[model samples]
Target: MLLSIIYVIGITAEAMTGALSAGRKNMDWFGVMLVASATAIGGGSVRDIILGNYPLTWVQHPEFLLITCVAGIFTTWVAKWVVKFKGVFIRLDALGLAAFSIIGCQKGISMGLHPGICIVAAIITGVFGGLLRDLICRQAPLVLHQELYASVSLVVAGLYLGLLHFGVSDVIATVSTLIIGYLLRMASVRFKWRLPTFTLNMEGSVH
Candidate 1:
């Protein structure tokens, strides 16, 4: 639950960043708000649907939508002043990634799944929402890039699993995972560490 709040806050920050960017580029206020709301919640909605968790967070707590909209308005209004510190968006995004990864893993564990499944599910939960946002923006997903993106989530998930095995409380495991994932993502970006692109040919056919 704490992780969920962190996830919401992280996405909210991203939404604001996206809104400000759009507004700076001369997008109308409505367009800016729409883009912000979409970026903030689109991924989680899809994740809930896929996981068969009916009545997603936004649906159950309609305030999620209301909050997102209000945040969009606030971002649009203040974007001109806030655009100077663009680097902050990266930090917020990393924090969000870590929070969501822990929440995802914890959610899976609560559902009584196997450890491996829980870890994989956690990684997906952390990433799927951002993936949706990128798809809508017509950009490649972060994990699909050569960056050490998904790897950070995977590592966090592994760490969370280890913590659980050692009988750590969910809160402890989650907080630790969030920190690890956030730091890993930040370090990867700062150091320009990334995964290698792979190419394979099968029987003269490129796949």
Candidate 2:
């Protein structure tokens, strides 16, 4: 049930971000919907494919696609009016990250994955959707930036993994991770806190 709610919120936020970007780029309705759909399901689709899950989640449960479509349309219609308040978008994105990261870590642990791999998977799951969204919109991926964005996912996933390692209940671990992730993200944005970027005096490769 918690996972379901998180999925809905994540999908809706993805649609909203895609819609906002599309409007800013002057994309047509079709292009907007494409971006919205991609942002909404790109991560989960990739994860399912990696896990060798056939038919994918949205494919097996087509209602998810319908929900994404409706959210895309709704965001497309309202984006212009709310464009000035981009902070709302950021907050929604952070919340989505917190929710999805916890869910991903839980799923990974349930599937008997290693704690380290589960943490990695959780970070990927949280960031991949937004990364694709930005890429499709011709912007830099959020995870590639010198921000506390992906760090939030890693921190939350690490906490969850630690708890699970100690044999904590799944619900408690998931909720604790989600709350900490969300709070940290909100505080980071509010205080403009970010992970420091590494710089080399040699000015060599950028990787």
Highest-scoring model, lDDT = 2
Candidate 2: lDDT of 44?
Answer: 72
Each prediction's Cα lDDT score? 0.74, 0.78
Give me the overall lDDT of model 2: 0.78
What's each prediction's TM-score?
Answer: 0.82, 0.87
Per-residue lDDT for 60-164 in model 1, tens only? 888777777778788866776667766787788889877766767776777787878777776776676566556555666756774577778789888988998
Clashing pairs in 2: none
Q: lDDT by residue for model 2 over 4-32, one digit each (tens)?
A: 88778878877777767777788888777
Query: How well does candidate 2 match the true structure, expressed as C-alpha RMSD?
Result: 3.0
Q: Model 1 shows how many backbone clashes?
A: 1
- What is the lDDT, from 0 to 100, of the residue 83 in candidate 2? 74
Worst 10 residues of 2 by lDDT: 44-53
